[model samples]
Target: MATNSTPKKPAADAPAEETAETVTKSAPARPARKSAPGPDVVGPALPAGAEPISVTLAHHHTIDGTDYPPSAKLLVSPDYAQRLRAQGYATPA
Candidate 1:
């Protein structure tokens, strides 16, 4: 008698079922990111019944080798942006 080292193939008549993890890309959903909560930034004022929202701020590196500090975001509202505009914060030409 001889031993068969060859593995037998799966039966074609059997039904196949995919598992939950296999159905997805095996990656979990991205979690929401939150900035550090502190009194570093003064919450800008908003109109009545309006709430403040967060906006990301990116520091720019100057070509002259000057660099700016990193800021996570600014708490801005419609009214606050308007006030900034009134202060000549308009985009440069």
Candidate 2:
């Protein structure tokens, strides 16, 4: 009968083992980023008629898959702009 007492060693080709906690701890934390300001489209007042007019958003909106951030200027129909203004969601640009 024979006995082996020597502790087994990792192979040279084996990669270093890391636990999830250790990996997470070693990773650098990322800081929160502020969204960049949207474009300024505020233009001259529209002539008195039924047409699209620019309005500044008071709240965020997602329309037709496009995101409209607060304070962003958007061109909308007169009726729609009126509705938004009445709801306090937008103001004339």
Candidate 3:
């Protein structure tokens, strides 16, 4: 007659086997942020003998993605200021 036997496990006092499990994790993605306008979008320089007019811009004046808060005062060229006034975006301060 033959007998079957099972392998024996390590003793409690024995060191445990070391395993090298490679678990790779990717970094989380970040959201895009809005950038401020550069010199290129500031428009051309003031013309000779031309002065900027002080006008209060309305809340809707967000042209070129620039922030112009409501009742904000700014100096702009005469032609541009006039246009803004006509469009109800600005008023003389």
- Structure candidate 1, residue pairs in collision: none
Q: What are the per-residue Cα lDDT tens digits for candidate 3 across 1-93?
A: 876688787798985565454335557776444343432323245678987676777754565556666776766677777788888888644
Backbone collisions counted per model: 0, 0, 0
Question: Model 1 Cα displacement at 85 (Å)?
Answer: 9.7
- TM-score-better candidate, 1 vs 3: 3
Q: Cα lDDT of all candidates, in order?
A: 0.49, 0.67, 0.63
Q: Candidate 1, residue 31: CA error in Å?
A: 40
Writing each residue's lDDT as its tens digit, candidate 2 over 1-93 gives: 989999998899997788787776665666554443344322234557757677888998655445668987777677677878898889644
Among the numbered candidates, top lDDT falls to: 2
lDDT, residue 79, candidate 1: 64
Score every model by TM-score. Answer: 0.29, 0.44, 0.48
lDDT tens per residue, model 1, 13-84: 986898786687666776654434543333455668876655443442121232223444455675654553
In model 2, pairs of residues that clash are none
- Ranking by lDDT, best first? 2, 3, 1
- Answer with 2 or 3, whichever has the higher lDDT: 2
The CA lDDT at 92 in model 2 is 46
Model 2 TM-score, all chains together:
0.44
